[model samples]
Target: MPHADTLTVVHHDDTRTSYTDVRYQLHRDGIRIWSDEGEHALTDILMTHAYRQREARAS
Candidate 1:
C-alpha cells in the first residue's frame, strides 16, 4: 500500500497517463481521494471504482 500523502502514477496501456495525489482519508474508510479537478468527478468516480474492482480480483 502507498504511504499517506504520496503520489501514484495512473496510466493505461493503450494511451493515457495521469498523476494522482493521495489526499486525506475518506472518513477512515482508508479510501484516499485522488487530487484532481472536481469538475471531472464522474470520470474520477468511474476510474476509482474500476481500479478498486481490479484490486479486489488481484487480492
Candidate 2:
C-alpha cells in the first residue's frame, strides 16, 4: 500500500435503498476503505454524492 496516504477516498454517495454513501463508506474503514471492485468503485460513488450535496446547498 505505497503512497496510501495520498490514496484518499476522494468522495462518496448513498445510492442504495438505505443510508447515504458517506455513512456507509465510513462505516467499516472510515476513509481508507478497500473493495474487490476496485478504487474508482467507491470513490466515484462518494464523488457524485459530494457534488450533489454541494450543489444542493448552493441552491
Candidate 3:
C-alpha cells in the first residue's frame, strides 16, 4: 500500500521583487521524507515530487 503522505509549505518569502522563496517539506507516515528550499511555486514543488516518484517506480 502507498504510504500516507503530506506536503507542507514550511516557509514563504514574498518580499523579493524577482521571485518568491518557497520552502517545502514532504512527510510520509508522519515522518519527514524530503524537504527543499528555493525560489519555486507550490505547483513546481508538487510536480517535482511527482516526477521523482515516477522515476523511482520506473527504476
Winner by TM-score: 1
Q: Give the root-mean-square deviation of each candidate in angstroms.
A: 10.6, 13.3, 10.5
Of 1 and 3, which scores higher on TM-score?
Answer: 1
Query: Which residue ranges in model 1 land beyond 4 Å of their true spot?
Result: 1-13, 22-36, 39-59
Candidate 2, which ten residues in sequence have the lowest lDDT sum?
A: 50-59
What TM-score does prediction 2 earn?
0.16
How well does candidate 3 match the true structure in TM-score terms?
A: 0.17
**Mind giving the per-residue lDDT tens digits that candidate 2 earns over 1-59?**
21221132333454432123222233333333433433333324343122123222211
Q: Rank the candidates by TM-score, best first.
A: 1, 3, 2
Against the true structure, whose lDDT is highest?
1
lDDT by residue (5-45, candidate 1, tens digit) is 33333333333334343333333222444455431211222
Pairs of colliding residues, candidate 1: none
lDDT of each: 0.32, 0.30, 0.28
lDDT of 3 by residue, 1-59 (tens): 12213333332342222222222334442222223343233322222221222222321
Off by over 4 Å in 3: 1-20, 29-59
Which residue segments of model 2 deviate by more than 4 Å? 1-30, 40-59
Q: Lowest-lDDT window of 10 residues in candidate 3?
A: 50-59
